[model samples]
Target: TTLLRQIAGFDFPDSGRITIGGESVERVPVEKRRIGMVFQNYALFPNMSVADNVAFGLSVRGEAKAVIATEVQRALDLVQLGKLGGRRPHQLSGGQRQRVALARAIVTKPRVLLLDEPLGALDKALRVDMQIELKRIQREIGITTIFVTHDQEEALTMSDRIGILRDGRLVQEGPPEEIYNRPKSEFAATFLGDANIFRGDSTGDGIRLADGTAIAAGVGAKLAAGAKASCAVRPERIRIARDAGTPDGNANMLKGQVSKRIFAGSNSTYFVERAGQTLKVIVQNTGMERLAEGQDVVLRWSPESTVLIAAN
Candidate 1:
């Protein structure tokens, strides 16, 4: 929120430059900066109609009435709320109200759009639907958007490039796939998604588990020999079976007992105990037999699925 505020000119930075469209806006006022922002709370005027709310920006700037009417309808249509222009904020559904907030933000055709957890107030289904809608509208308008959210799934779903920040510093920035699959640090690995982290001494190629098992990690293995390192394996990449089947030369294997099981609609999660560490494994339910709690199982995954990271 502080960072967004700085860019919006609501707050000034202690030291540094804020550039929008390759131009510095250090001395620019909020309205003149040509930035549009939508808050988590929607921040709509309670007594105004939807069209009035959408036209507020252009109206404040003294735009001609005819121009404001045309732009307001266009913005409302862009958000699929064209028919609800006469309704007040209180008369609309949560999703409709959100659309009103978005329409209002984009009505003035700002150069940059800043969304601070705009969908945080919606229900899960509505939020998911809005994620797709938001992406569609963004691509159609081709506006540079900066979205801030603590929900990991939301970040992954709506981003083209993701920047993971910790304590006001950027920990990592890359395409979503790269950040999720090839994290550079333990914080980045665990923050973006669920990861089964193995901590041990590095062997240049991979890390040796505490139980003397060699786990191979071909990606991001930059640590020197005998140094403290860790490898992260996403739960979905692991395959769990009751049989200690033939070991493949290219795969890492572990023997453990299922300590717990959770049944989600489309998948199942198994907590396996091995070497004093509980590893999480997610398996999709594809008509396959399910493993029971307390059952001995063998876990296998490809070396390519493992991500090597420096221990914090």
Candidate 2:
């Protein structure tokens, strides 16, 4: 209900201001906001041609026929579908239909555009291509867009700033790298990607693992000694097989037995077991002897790379 209901007055503590061209729009009308929205589906009329659908928004606004034709042609050309103006939604492929829908939304010349899972309907390859297309179009138009997507890659690739919403609350919001590399909470770390979270024990001066392994991380020193802590390291940063010893600056190294291995395209993921729990590590087809299951391996990560977080 919280997500469905649009309250009359609700302002988040910190989502930046809702402004358009330097003007505060706290009480602006929804339609007058000049904000265009593109939904998951193409939302094109089956009976209408590409030109008619692209011109729908302006026609609804009671614009002149000449203006509508001009805007429609320009919008169609923007999507590279000018030659398909006579084709209806039924005649167009999924990707082509989406392009038409996008052209329609932007034809109104909105200051801000909102995209709700815009590429969700396309297949994997088409989705990736559309993701690039969407970003390219956004850059070309230069509109401040707020995109909603469940795909992490899409959000990180397209959005200038991503607002992660969970359970009706905005959990985390930041640029792609900041949100992915420096998560403020454990939830953020795990949700954004796979993480190797280990229980940390605070030493008198620094933080260490529960197994008496000390990390070179000084940020966790803010916590009192003997305090419980939580630390995380990304799978990609952990080296699977490195001659069974320390490599360099990665002070946090743990020896674990490979319990399971799963191949995923170019990268193969391994589940390692240590200290009665499982940890994950990903290795991109490095010519190292294909790590076999049940083989002992050392998980290595840089001291600075391991995110030292407080126990939540």
Candidate 3:
């Protein structure tokens, strides 16, 4: 919140600079920043009606009553709450309250919109629904939005580009797919999703895990032989079978015994133990028979699917 408050002008930056819309906003007041912020808690006034809440920003600026009414109704309609204008925060559902908060932020037509875990308060189902709804509203308004969330899936699903922050510093920034598939570091690879890491010496061709298993990886530059390096593979990219059975020549292969299996509704995750390491593989549930725990399995994946990085 402190970071966001600084950008919103509630607090001053101690160093560096703050700019918005091609102009420095370090000296701009909060009310003049034209930055709309929706807090994690939705921060809707419980005593105010939905219409009043949506119109609050414009009203505070002394906008005419007719203009406030028009903008408030338009914002409410955009959030699909056109008929709930008279409802109070306490009387609305969690998703409805979220929409109300969003309406309030956007009703003033700010140049930039900041959302702090906007859907964090909703239940799983409602949160998913709001993700879609929020994206829809954002597109309709075409406003530049900065969304902050600890939920990896939400960031992936709702962002055009993502910046991963670690210890107040940006570790990586790129399109979601690029960041997920070609993470520059172990923290980025594992933090964004599930990654099975192979850590050992780089063999100039690929990575040789601690067990002496050399896994081929397609890397931009070959690492010097005997250099400490690591490679990561996403769980879903690996294919598991009873045997190698003439796997692709360019693919890396490993044999292991299934140590455990997690049965999610849409998918199944298997933890395979091979040479003192556990490799994770996720497969979609096609209503087919799945390998049981303790079953021997062969894992194969193309070299291109593996990401190589320094062992740091």
Give the whole-model CA lDDT for all candidates, comma-separated: 0.93, 0.77, 0.90
lDDT of 1: 0.93
**Cα lDDT of model 2 overall?**
0.77
Residue pairs in collision within model 2: 250-302
Candidate 1 worst ten-residue window by lDDT: 243-252
lDDT over C-alpha atoms for residue 105 of model 2 = 87
* Per-candidate TM-score against the hidden true structure: 0.98, 0.88, 0.96
The count of backbone overlaps in candidate 2 is 1
lDDT per residue, candidate 2, 196-224, as tens digits? Answer: 77776766434677667786553332667
Tens digits of per-residue lDDT for model 1, 1-312: 889999989999989999998999977999999999999999999999999999999999999999999999999999999998999999999999888999998888899999999999999999999999999999999889999999999999999999999999999999999999999998998899999999999988899988789989979859899999999999999999998688688999999999999999899999999988999999999997888889999999998999888878
CA-RMSD of model 2: 3.5
lDDT of 3 by residue, 153-219 (tens): 9999999999999899899999999999999889999999999988889888788977778888885
